[model samples]
Target: MPSVRTILALIASSVTVLGGALAEPTVALPATACTTGAPMTTAGYPIPYYAQATPSTGAFENGYQPEPRWAGQHLVGTYTFGVPSPVETGFAYAQFKCQYYCLNQSEGGSFFVRADSKVGSYCECYDDLMDPETFVNNNQTLIGAWNAICKEA
Candidate 1:
């Protein structure tokens, strides 16, 4: 038989080993870091009819005209631009597209800004001419399209 002191020592060693085995391991997580880059801004606007078409001449009436598919409430367009850091280039491109390609009275407008070093910065504009309900339903599709565009860029 083991001596009392030897049994006590064995029990203490087993307890110590078991305690270590049952204890949770400690994990050292990385510290949270702050964003050190400059801030970005995104903006959008409605295009005016006058900017989309030439003035009416004496012989011909020249004004903004929508295609048959885009006649009433089924028009949609998206424009995207990328720059080093600032959002002005993307904003300007979106504005230009709205002025030249989108309907004069765009009912819905969406803008997104992304700041990334590998992907750089992106500004996106979505021009929606559909009815409110239709636009709402197609919102997911618009977001997916923008994501695709952003990934490609």
Candidate 2:
């Protein structure tokens, strides 16, 4: 009893909804981990992790990259920095954690330009354009821990 146009419109709507149903579910993106604001947590644990380099948005929480080493030691496998040279230049040390590939981009190094902002402790944020951020890491111990975690991962 439906008209031609009405039937066609119904078929099209059905196809669109059915297509979405047949498609695989999308994965959730990682969160930010900048220091300008207080560290955040999921459930109860801290979302501490690193990225290969700052993301396009340049927020730690936006996404996470894994580390690959501790201090100057090797992690496990050969890795290529996901970011560009300009991003690397800003990092103090760089590496990835071969063990924990699924855990925070494998414990890779960060591109922080501070003297106090480590993993846990709050500081400021860093940027290649604006003035230096206050959450960037500055503590040697934390940096060491970061590298070590990357190696173990």
Top lDDT hit: 1
Candidate 2: tens digits of C-alpha lDDT, residues 17-99: 99988968899864332223222232232424433233235444322332212212422223322322333322222222221
Clashing pairs in 1: none
Q: What's the CA RMSD for each of the models? A: 18.6, 17.1
Candidate 2: lDDT over CA atoms? 0.32
Instruction: Report the CA-based lDDT of candidate 1 relative to the real structure.
Output: 0.34
Query: CA lDDT of each candidate?
Result: 0.34, 0.32
Candidate 1 lowest-lDDT run of ten? 144-153
In model 1, state the lDDT of residue 52.
Answer: 18
Find the 10 residues in a row with the least total lDDT in model 2.
Answer: 122-131
lDDT string for model 1 (89-134, tens) is 5444444343343333232333233333454333333343222222
- In model 2, which runs have C-alpha deviations exceeding 4 angstroms? 5-17, 34-153
- What's the true lDDT of residue 73 in model 1? 38
